[model samples]
Target: MAFSADELRVLRRALATALNPAPLQGEDVQDCLRLAEAVDDAVREAGRLRAFLLADLARYREALPGSLPGYLELLQDALAAGYDPAVDDLAALRALRANPRAAVLLDRCQVLAERSVRARLARVTQTAVATTPRPRVRLLALPGGRAADEPKPTPAPPPAERPVPKPSEVFPPRRRPVPPPPPEERAAG
Candidate 1:
């Protein structure tokens, strides 16, 4: 598909960014690899989509009208031409010649990109879940640890009889009684 000079420049920039190498630390090797894989997949998918959009835009452009059909058409053309719709923030490009068709195309492209990203993320998430290790907990049962199941120790029986007190000790000796105090002191003093 033929693209305008501006469209070609945008596509070149996008490809450069996509291919650029990102610096990685030792600890980040695995993460970096995952990211690189994901990015590679995304780039491939985006390239395919870009080609398709470009073809559609070419067909639409061949039937271009004198005035703007809508903003959606312009946005579709820009995306089809490989201009990263995500990077284009200024509405001016979308509103070129005040076409509403461009805006609609931008919305559609945004939805498509979001769906693609979600699908990729789901795949990685499922893979991570499958590869993750489960934690193990061990339970040990020791012999004689439980009171109910363990044999009880036999207790010695008490002595046959307690010692009995002797009769002499029970009925001790008796002493002579002392005389009473003086009779007058004894009488209710």
Candidate 2:
């Protein structure tokens, strides 16, 4: 989010005081509080605006081909705000494919739908993995328990311990190998 100059100034002063451990003036504290409230208000307004936009989109979707303009506008705005298109939106776009814009939107929405599904699947996989019991990792030595099942990460050997990779292996080959200079040229050389 872009911060205004005033907000940025307040933020800078607050951070400076935080790091330097200097006592803040009453006015500085007030400014920081005001900035926090402004940030909270902006967040709330964003949520409300998104909710309203979603409601309007649903209404327009129900109105079908008749409210195409408003539907498309709201859908585009929602998409810009990271709203995942619903199945209904996909269906509506497909049905309205006679409109060139709707056809294009259908393609875009299809891509978004696939991405959303993949994200959801990834989340579910992560959640499943997280929920399955893992050996508790302890930072400090546990009093009497067995060590964690996960092996401790081994530290990398010092630079001198192993030979460094050649530059070609470290970096990708920048150019394709010259074609063997042809068999006749090789023999001549």
Give each model a TM-score. 0.28, 0.67
Candidate 1, residue 51: Cα displacement in angstroms equals: 6.9
Over 4 Å off in model 1, which ranges? 1-97, 137-189
Per-residue lDDT, model 2, residue 169, is 87
Model 1 agreement with the true structure over 1-189: per-residue lDDT tens digits: 455565455555555656985664564555445555666777898788877765654454445443345434555556555455443323443445355654555566667667767888999999999999988868766566576587878999987996888987898878879988998997967
In model 2, the runs with Cα more than 4 Å from the true position are: 134-189
lDDT, residue 182, model 1:
91
Q: What is the lDDT of residue 7 in candidate 1?
A: 48
Residue 141 in candidate 1, Cα distance off native in Å: 11
lDDT of 2 by residue, 4-100 (tens): 9999999999999888998888999999999999999999998999899999899999998889998998999999999999999999999999999
**Deviation in Å, model 2, residue 182 alpha carbon:** 94
Model 2 poorest ten-residue lDDT run: 142-151
